[model samples]
Target: MIDLEEIRIVLVAPSHPGNIGAAARAMKTMGLSRLYLVSPESYPHAEATARASGADDVLARALVCQDLDEALRGVTLVLGTSARARSLEWPTIPPRQAAERINAESGGEAAIVFGRERSGLTNSELERCHYRVHIPANPEYSSLNLAAAVQLLCYELALAAEAGPVDDPTPAISEEDPREAYAEQIEVERFYVHLEAALAEIEFLDRENPRQLMRRLKRLFNRTRLLRTEVNLLRGILTAAQRQAKLARGG
Candidate 1:
């Protein structure tokens, strides 16, 4: 069973309170809850409550976060909504496929991140996501309102839930598999920090001239969807490298 509560609707830096409220309404109408507001420009305002139109419960219960990292603390799977393609070419999928993928997760928190109304997700923000859900609207003018985008994706999620899990030939992840306990966003982030430090220690990444080195590595791992055990193993290797580098330097 797909627990709607486990699927969080994350709004990143939403500038309008009305959109937040309307987004909540859209979620409630579709049997979705668990809204996470990341650095909302305006919230707990009268307009938001007014726009909720009886879904104020969703607004009241919304978790306010300082940033995407905070909002995604326990989330294992993350999908960011994007209106167009990017140069990096993330694992792009339509809303239906995104919904199916979210539904297929056996456990742990999953997030569908909605960016600001004007600029959408920035490069750094998009890099945090494992996949990008691209809504194919009329290309001539594909501009979509924040609330409208939330409504569309939420609708697909509800539909996917009602229809039950799709029949797929692939074997489901077992409890014994590390995939069952995929590394959480916070843990993965810690590994990145460790990686950067290890690289600098070994003089692999020039601290002053570091450009796309980290970004490219992030893309590689994000696409890989590393498991918890894999992350631990990688970090252990980085630790060994750092130790060896220090020994060579007579530290």
Candidate 2:
């Protein structure tokens, strides 16, 4: 059985204590147990207890922390919820995708963070998260309540759990076969060399006045975090360009 103990729902600076209680109830309905609160306005109140609706147990066992970092402590993965897309870049994935990732990574402690009801998570708070999860809603009006968002995420997670872990059908390659490398495993030096060579061949990087060409190119490629196939393709293109250049120079 996929243990719900590994998953935690974190509320940051929740304005309404009743919403917190309701969120606890929603989480319990989906079999999620852990609840972490980061500086809630007023917890353990009569209103919160009343709103819990027989789910006060969830609230009772919830962890209360002073700040976001304190609540996030010992959590290997953190996901932040957002309704509107922000100008700043963050790793954004749909709810389904996020659920799959969470299930796969449930071996470690993980938490899904929801912000205040009024304003939602700020850009800085979103930046603290490893990934951003956005629930799909009607494009015309997509405002989701705190409890609703928690319900949707918990539902997706439960569905994912029922569906079972996703399998990679592709057989592992033998030593003789070309092993595919993940983006993290690819050598940065090789990419730099390939890029520099390609740029030189194209006369894009002038030696006389190379103001910021290389730096810009480096930033661009680094952003991509190129996978094995992408790196190989780039190197191939650079090799072809070099060959063409050599032929032109009468090599």
Candidate 3:
């Protein structure tokens, strides 16, 4: 059973309040809830409410966050929306495939992260996601408004939900409760900060000339979608390394 409640549609740094409201409306129409706003340029503005048309409840309940990291908290699976090609190719899938993949998750929070209107998601931001979805559009003029992209993806998700179980015959791999619990996005961010500090302490990461080192690390870790226990274990290892360094320096 696909629990639509567990799906979260995230907007990253949206510039228009109206788009936010309209996106909420789209989600509501498709039987989806849980909208997360990551550092929108404008929100709670009258324009947004007005644009939402009749979905005021969705607008009122929207969860606003300071950044994408905060918006993705508790989300075990993250799919980013992007149109342009990147130097580093991620697991790219079409909208339908993205919806089906997310629908197949046994239980856990899944997020479809959309970017800003003008620039979309930056390369660094996209790296934080496990997969990226592309919406087919006219190649000559493929630029899509933030709200339109949300609507299209939500439509696909809605269709996938109503179409019954996916027909794929591949057996789902079993693990020790993959959905038991996952570390919040904030916890992951904290680990990255701690990891960077440790790397600097050991002279492995040069702050002055750190070029894409942290971004690469983020991709490496995000791919695994670390569980809460896994995060704690990694942090413990980080603390141990820090302590060892302190002892070596007689501090």
- Those runs of model 1 whose alpha carbons end farther than 4 Å from true positions after fitting are 167-172, 176-180, 209-211
lDDT accuracy of residue 121 in candidate 1:
95
lDDT tens digits, residues 1-251, model 3? 35776689999988989999999899989888789998888888999999989988888889999888788877767899999887667778899998897777655578999988888899867876778899999999999888889899999989988876674322343446654465666677788889999877777899998647887778778777677677889889988898888888888
Candidate 2 global lDDT: 0.74
**How would you order the candidates by TM-score, starting with the best?**
1, 3, 2
Candidate 1 lDDT, 87-140, residue by residue in tens: 667778899998988887776789999999989998788888988999998989
Q: Give the number of the best model, judged by TM-score.
A: 1
Each candidate's TM vs. the true structure? Answer: 0.92, 0.66, 0.85
* Candidate 3 or 1, higher lDDT: 1
Candidate 3: pairs in clash: none
RMSD of each predicted structure = 2.0, 10.1, 3.0
Q: Pick the candidate with the highest lDDT.
A: 1
By lDDT: ranked, best first: 1, 3, 2
After TM-score superposition, the amount by which residue 62's alpha carbon in candidate 1 deviates from its true location, in angstroms, is: 0.4
**lDDT value, residue 244 of candidate 2:** 85
Give the local distance difference test score of model 1: 0.88
List the global CA lDDT of all models: 0.88, 0.74, 0.82
